[model samples]
Structure formats: C-alpha cells, structure tokens
Target: MSKLTFADMQNPLFLHPSDGSSSIQIEKLHGPEDYRSWRRQMEIILTSKRKLGFATATVTRSTEDATLGDQWDSCNNMVIAWIHTNLSPSIKKSVLFFTTAREVWKHLETRFALSNGSRKYKLNKDSYGLKQNSTSVYDYFPTLNVIWEEMDSMNMLPIITTVSDEVKRNLEEVEKRKGESKLFQFLNGLDEVYVPMRSQLLMMNLLPSVETASSVIQQEELQRQLLSNPRHDMEMSAMFSRGQTGGDRVVVCKECGGKVHLSDKCWYVVGFPNGHPNHGRILMKPGSMNQSWSIWNKNNPGNKPKPAGNVAGSASNAVVFSPQQLEQLMQLLPSLSKQPSKASKTDDKLDSHFSGMMSYHNALNNDLGWIIDSGASDHMTPHFQKLIMPTLVTNLTPNIKLPTGDTVAITHM
Candidate 1:
C-alpha cells in the first residue's frame, strides 16, 4: 500500500503489455526493407496497449514523487522490451542497451525511416514500375496496393475545417481523379495476355475503382488457371468430340454448354482441324456450337461442302437381304443371346448382339487427340499403361453386363 502511486490509479500498467518477455505476435522485423510494414503493425499493438506514449516520450515520469517515478520507469522498460522482442537478432543487439523506450524508438527511426522526399520518390517509382509480370494476380495485386498505400500516406490531403458545398464537390473530384489514376496504373501493369480483360475493364461506363478492378482481375486469374491445363481441357473436349470416355468427373464448358471441354479448341465447336476425317465439318455440337454453325451455314450455305458418295470399288458392296434371309437372321438372334462368349467379340458385334457391350480399345487418333471408344464398355481401357493415375474402387457392385454377343469384362474399368 505504501509503494502504491497515484499514477497506478490514473494510468495503470495492468492495461499495458506485461513486459519485454511478452512476445509481440506479428511478423518479426528484418531490417529497413521491412521497417514500414513492421512499424505500422507495431503502432497498432502499442497504441491499443496504451504504451505507445512511453515510446513517443509523451508519457513522462513524475518528478514530484518517487513512487510515480518508479511506475513510469517500469512502464518505459516494458515498452522498450516489447520493441526488442519484435526486432531481428542483428537489430536487437544495437538497441539492447538503450535506457528508455523513447531513445530506442528514435534510434530505430533515424536508422530506418527514410526521409520524406527519398521515400516518396521510391514509392512513386514502385507504383509505376510494379507489374504483374510472371506472378499471379492474387500475389501481384497486394504488392501493388502496398506501394500505393505508402504513397498515399506520404501525400495525404490536408484537413480543412470550413465546410462548403464547393469544397466537398472539389474534394470528391480529386478523389475520383485519384481513383482513375490508380485504375490505369493497375490495368497498365498487367501481362499482355490480359489485354482483353484490361480492355473490358477500361470500357466500363463509370470507370470502376481500383478495388473493383482488382477483384475482377483476380477472378480472371482463377479462370486462366483452369483454362491453362491442356490435358484436362483436351480430355474434356474429347468426351463430346470423338465419343464418350467413361468417368464420373464432370467437365462443363462455359462457351458451348458442352460437358467435357474448356479446350473449346474443342473439335465439336471449332470442328476437326486439317487432316482429321471430320475436317472442315462440325462433328458434334452441344447447344451453342449447333446454334453457331446453323447461323454460319445459313449465312454461307454455298461455302458448305456437300458430302461425297463412296467410290464403288473402295470398300465393299452393300448387301441387300431377301425376305427369306431376314426371317433366318431373326431366328438365329434368339439362340445367340443364351450363349456366353468365350472370346472377346470384335467391336462391330456390339450392335449385332443387341447387348450393349463395347470394345474399350484405344484406337487413338493423334490428329483428333482423343481415343475413339464408346462409353458402354466393360472396361474403360484395354491397356494397363493407359491407367496412369487410377483410383481403385474397393466396395463392389455386381458388374453390369452389356449383353454383348461377346464382351470380356476385366477387373479395372
């Protein structure tokens, strides 16, 4: 009770962080390069704890009483210790012996904080020079914002007391101009690939703020990430392009409303390229692709090529079944259905058997970039090597058979 001071009653150390040993939970300061960000964080923590006054030298020791003086000294030591805990090993050694919180803070400031002119010049230079070169928009946007924030801090508008409509309007105009400048800066620094995105943003009527523009660009980045994977996209395209390949994973295309390809490098949409059997012809269309072709065909019907008749000697003659032969085939179909096939029937038998089995052979056409296989197969792939990243299903259902005159079911689909 005797050692208790009036300072304890008015400005209590209980509200402050306990001591230097009490670690500041923040990104530890490295050096001058990290000083600005570190300082901003430190200020927030110190201010909340009411110990910032000690660092600033605004909270003074009482000369009138020894008890109050001791209280101030203890608080000052605590503040000084808190700062030290956040410093790098190299920086800690230099300020380790500083007697007061104010002295430590001033020494660090003098060592690290750049002069207004130099810092302002550097920040301005960074704002212009900063580009989303090789990095993602998620990573690059934040870094650009950091530079802009520092620049804004350096060139803050002056506070005015006399309020007027004209002043308010003029201030708003200044803000709009500043926003426009930031928007341009953000768009300009994007990689050349995003020219379409940048153009779209710029073409907006009211002109979006930097924050709005950044959000749009970030979404674009995510879409770009999705579109960049050629394997996934090409696989997706093949689902509809050549035929169905069995998989549960769904691929939906934004352009043509097709289920498989974002590589709307899609054979269905773009049609087959040169050398492909379906070249210069629309192979398949899922909605939009069909509509587009219909419009194109209607617009240029003369340019569309007519299908060519097969040359007589190229393959074989078309067989014409007599009424007697048709009756004989129908009688044989019933007897064929009961017998299990010992050997895997050829793929053409799939339709003949009326049993839905298909040959899961990888007749890979490199020109078409997809395996020509129907989805109604007992196995997804005939070759073991094609199962590059296979997931085994443990729990089993009774294997469904396509009534193939002969379909050999393998262990893995």
Candidate 2:
C-alpha cells in the first residue's frame, strides 16, 4: 500500500496525538539540501563536544529498524532542535514521532474497513454444478466469477455441476509444486550446482567434437655453399665440396661450417681471439653483461664511435654519483647478496661498502625516499628517469675485470 498522509488520521502509523505533546510541531524544511546541512552541523557539534572531553555517540538506524519507528520517538525533540538551529528558518519544520505499533495497526484496519467494499472484495460463484465436484470455497470463487455473467444461460449448468475430488486435489498439488519449482529455479540460477556423474558424462557426450591437425615440411637451400671455394686443404676440401655439388646434402654455412649466423660466426671464430683455440676470446659466452651492453647500444644509437662530448671530460671512464644520489643508492646494497661471488664484492668489502653506504643511507632514509631491493635480479629506479641527463648507474666499479679478465662489472643504485 502507498504511504498514508497526515490527513489519514485513522492510519495508526501516521497518528498525531490530540492532546498537548501529541501534537506535532512540523516547522516545514526544504528537501535533501537542508537535511544535509543540518546533519553536517550535528557532526561539527559532536566533534567539538568530544574535544571538550565530553562523551558522545551516534546511534544510527538500519533501514528496517528506522521504518519500525520506536527508536525515533525519544529523539523527536533532539531532531526538532537540530532542524531549527541547523536549517534555514524558512525551511525548518518539526513533527511528532509515534511510540506504539498498536495505534498504527488500529488506524490501518479502520482505513481498510472504510474502503469501497466492491473494490476491496471481488465476489464469485460457480453455476451448473454438473459433477458435484468438491473443492475449497476459495477455489470455487474464481470459477464462479469467470462465469458469473453467464449464470442465467442454460449452457452454464454444466460447469457448476462438475468438479471432481481428484481434480481439486491435483490442482492444489500442482499449485504447491509450481511455487516450489519457481523458488528452486530462482535460487539454482544464482549459484553453481553439482551434477550426477552419469548426467555429467551424458552432457559431455552431447558436446561437439574438437579436432586438431599437425603438419611437417622440409626444404633445402644451397646457394651460399656453391659460391664459396677454398684452396688450403684441397683434397679433403674436394671431398667435402663434391658432396654438396653432387650429393643430396644441403650445407647451411659455406664460410664457417655452422648453422647459425655465418657472418657473425665467422667474425667470432676467425676474427675474434675467443674462437678455435688459436684466438684468445676473453669475454665469457654472451650472457647478462652482453645482453645489457646490447640493450644499451640499442637504446643509444647516437652513442656510437665515441662517448658524447658533454660527457667526454667528466669521469666518463669512472662512475659518477652526487651526494644525494649516493645516499639513494645505499639502500640497494642489501640486495647484492643474491649475486654470485663473481658478480659481487667479497663479504669484507661489502661490509665496508655497507658501513659507508649506510651512514649516508640512514641520514636520508626518511627524506630520501629510497628502497633497497637486494632481492631484485637487476637494478632499476626512477632516479635515472628524473635527471636532465640522468646518471643511471652509481657506486659503479670501473675497469674492474672479472677473474676471466675479459668482461667488467658495473654496479648501480
């Protein structure tokens, strides 16, 4: 039912007392805008009171509880006071709160009784009771109304005479099942359900089949092999060369006899010292250092031929760090433990480095905004991105050859 207006005095829920305190002082307030302002004022007052060492608590209402109304009865005065003081005088208003449910129920029952009987209650009856069916009076009412206007018709006699006891019982059962089934369907759709194993298997069988196909292909290219001819080991080379020209054999590298990059492979194995034992290749096989070097080159294509002139005079050879930069790098010292001995300093040197690193590190810990991630596999930071020409690495050891004496290590914070 729609809410009862104050004019509906019989509505117990909307009751206004006739005597003294029962009368509501409804100092009308504008809508939500004024309500919010009043609420804010109450908060400020409560906060101030709390500051003055007075205890205060805010009792809020759940939707259902508030609708029930009992809690608001005693607080009616406080609500009125709040509305009057906090809201614009033009908008503020007050109303009395009812305390009992009995009054509200009584008013509602009275209002219901006064409503037009024809509108509130629909009357119906069955005619032509042909089969003398037995059903509850409630069940007969709808059938009665369906044929009510036709009651005078001779053909109407058949319907009124005939409902079976079994039919009535069956209808009741069907109605009950319908209600239960609707509930089950609603709840089942909301959550997952376990299926019987056989049912699951049957569902799986009904699904469409999935098909996958695999293929293999082979091809040979021999242009490079045919082009390159050599003289150093003629006879043995002849046997090798003949196999390619006449035999079904397909060779990949005519220059170096390797499958991967021929030009690059030729340079390393023949030109660089590390290959064939005839040359002394000092750098370890391409790994982290080489990857970093390649990445740096890729990022800085313009850095080719020589270092930039602006950086030429600086300790371009030595690593650089500002005092603040040095302080920031110190935190990363803890993470160095993950590196192998070859990649990091000895325990004593690290301890010494920590001692120096921490002194500066601790002083700036609060203000410096730095983090030590010894656990990180590689060093990275926002510090590098911040500079006009950001020095990306700090506390770096330069020309510090590894035991192999070919590659160097640089540390950064």
Candidate 3:
C-alpha cells in the first residue's frame, strides 16, 4: 500500500476566485462548554468560504501529479490555517501536526462532543424549567428563544409532523405549535397578575405572534402603572385639561373668618360660639350690665351682634354670677384696687401670681421620705430637719385657713 500524496486529495475541477474579503471572525473555543457554539459558527464560516469540502472530505493519495499535488497542499494549508487561528492556545498542542482539516475537526469533535447526550439532557431540562422569576419579559424571552433555537438545531425537540402537504400546511402547523409552546412557556414564567391575559391567549383559536404578545404585555404593564399611581393619572388628566383647578379648593370659613380652615380648627368645633368664648365677655364687675357689655364689645371691629346679650343671666351675660364666680370677683377687687379701674394691670398681677405658683409646684421634687405616720388626723411635721426632701414654699400668701377656723403659715414641706 502506498502512502497518500497531496495530489490524490486535490479536486482539479473545483475553482473559487479570491475576493479579498475578511474571514468570518468566530470566537475561539475555550473549553468543552464552548464546543457546540464554536462548531456551529466555524461550520457557517467554512460553508460561506467554500472550504467546508476541504474540512469534511477524506484525504487519500491515489495520484501523484505535481500540479494536483500543489493544489491539494494549498487547500489543506488554507483549512489548517483557518482552524488554527480559531483554536485557543491551550488546545493547540494536541492538533499542531494535523496535515488535514478533517483530522483537526475530528479530534475536537471526539474530545469535546462526547457529552452530547448530557448536553441535550441538560438543555431539555433547562428549556422546560426556565422561569421568569426576577427577570423582566424583555430579558427573559431572548434567553428562551436562544434555548429553543439551539434545541431545534440539535434536533432535540420532538417532531410534530411528518406527513407532507402541498402548501406546506403541515410545516406551518408545526411552527405554529412550536410558537404556542414557547408562548405557553413564557406565560407560565410570568407572574400571576398576567393570569387573565395568559388565559385569553390560550383560549384564542390562533395564538398571537410573540412580538404581538410582547406588545400586549407591555400595554398591560402600562395599565398596571396607571392603576397603581392615582396621582400620576390625575397629573396626566390635569396636563390635558384646560386651566382647571388641580387640588382641593380653598373656601372661606364662616366661623373663624379664614380661608381653607379645617373643620377641627373651626371656632364652633373647638367649643367656642361667636368665634371665641372669651372674645366678647368681661372678666370683672360681674353685676354691672351696661359697663361690662361696653367693655366686652369695645375691641370688636366688625360690630357683630353679641350672642350672649340675648340670653339673660348666661355666664357671659353681665347679670350672671355663680358662687365660684362671686368668689373669683371678690379676690380680683384687691388686685384691681391697687391699679384703680385699670383692668389690664389687674389682669397682669393675677396672671403673674398664678403662673408663679404653678412654676413653684412643678419645681418640687417627687421623692417622698419613707417616714410613715399612724393615727394621724392631719399632716404634721415634727421638725424641719426630719423632712428628708423638703421643698420651700415661697412668694405665696402666708396663711392657709383650716376648716376649724385656724390659719397656719406654710414654710417648708
């Protein structure tokens, strides 16, 4: 048997003109994981360049013509060059001495394509198991389409039709079913909010194209946005409207004479009629009707009719005085006497005394002594030193009258 020569592998009739076009730049295969995609891309390039026959053809040496031998060597070298440029450096050593493209191609196939069954199994599992989860529809469908296309190319997907039709109706039906399967898978991966839309799609006699379905889903998303944001809808409406008032209109409050007053802020709601309860009432000289009413309405800029005037002997009316009112009036006379008919001056002293007393009481510490008193009718202190946390009572009137007609001065407690 004679060893094969380059002439025997050359095809004399094969002719292809050089066009000075760049080679298709397929990505270099990194490892076993990249084999399938790399192979697909390289095959496309080889076919387009009219060099696929060189890669697929068997090498044999039956003739030794010098011209044929040179042509064969040129074709083989071109194929080898193309293959070598597209291989990663790590895998180059194994195929460095390969004289024919077939050898290199076959070696790669044998080494990496061993896991085809496992690859097919994994692809099938992934295709069926894919879910939208956190992925958006735009992001998710492309991935699914890629997987579907890969499966179809591998002949891994089941054949839906074998019978022939003149118009290729059977083929169309197969494609339609494939589209529906993809649509169903996409819908399944969607959130439950799309359940109604999914049902509508499923119920249709013919499913919409994926692009159409995507558009509908996008519209659904817009509708969802509009539904969730009422303020946004209102703003959009307002933008389209012709100079309409956009928010709650301000109305004049009848009671407080203010604009946009809340019901809670209304004088009537706050338990004050005729604006404020204290607005038109006299604080001193409860018995004198004429003098009190004159002073009460003196500051009224709007001459509004006094509601208290009609109800005689009402608390706001000058003729009325309860026992507590009478006592308060008697106490006011001394304070008023010092200022002699100047009510504002008398009010200042009264406010100062009450405020000062309240401040003093609040300042007192709450820590009480542990000392217990038994059979005591009245509170008593044995000595000042025995009072562990005594607070000095200051600036108050000296004496407090007891029920037994005795008055005692409060010093410290």
- lDDT on C-alpha atoms for all candidate structures: 0.71, 0.36, 0.64
Q: TM per model?
A: 0.54, 0.15, 0.46
Once fitted onto the true fold, the runs of candidate 3 whose alpha carbons sit more than 4 angstroms away are 1-22, 58-68, 114-117, 156-169, 218-413
Residue 159: error of model 3 in Å?
13
lDDT of 2 by residue, 1-413 (tens): 98656556432223233323322233233543233233334446533322111112133333677664553443333333433443344433222232232232233234332223332232211133311143332343334333332222212323335669987897677656544433232222221222232233235533221110000000001222344545546867667766655653544554444543444556444566444564654433334343544555465453332321222355443323566756745765655655565443555455444432311111112223532323324343434431223444665656443343355544333
Residue-level lDDT of model 1, residues 1-413, one tens digit each, is 47656685446454434345565677778877778889889989888777888888888888999987887888788787788888888999999999998999999988998888888888888889998887998888899888888788778888999979999999999999999998999898999989998998888889999999989988988888888867987776766655643555666776556655675566766677789887876444446434644554565454442222233454232223456756756976665676556334533353454332222332233322333334332235445544534566655655544444255445554
Q: After superposition, which runs of candidate 2 have C-alpha atoms over 4 Å from their true positions?
A: 1-101, 108-168, 180-413
Kindly indicate the candidate among 2 and 3 with the higher TM-score: 3
Q: Which one wins on TM-score? A: 1
Best by lDDT: 1
Give residue 349's error in model 3 in angstroms: 16
Report the candidate with higher TM-score, 1 versus 2: 1
The TM-score obtained by model 1 is 0.54
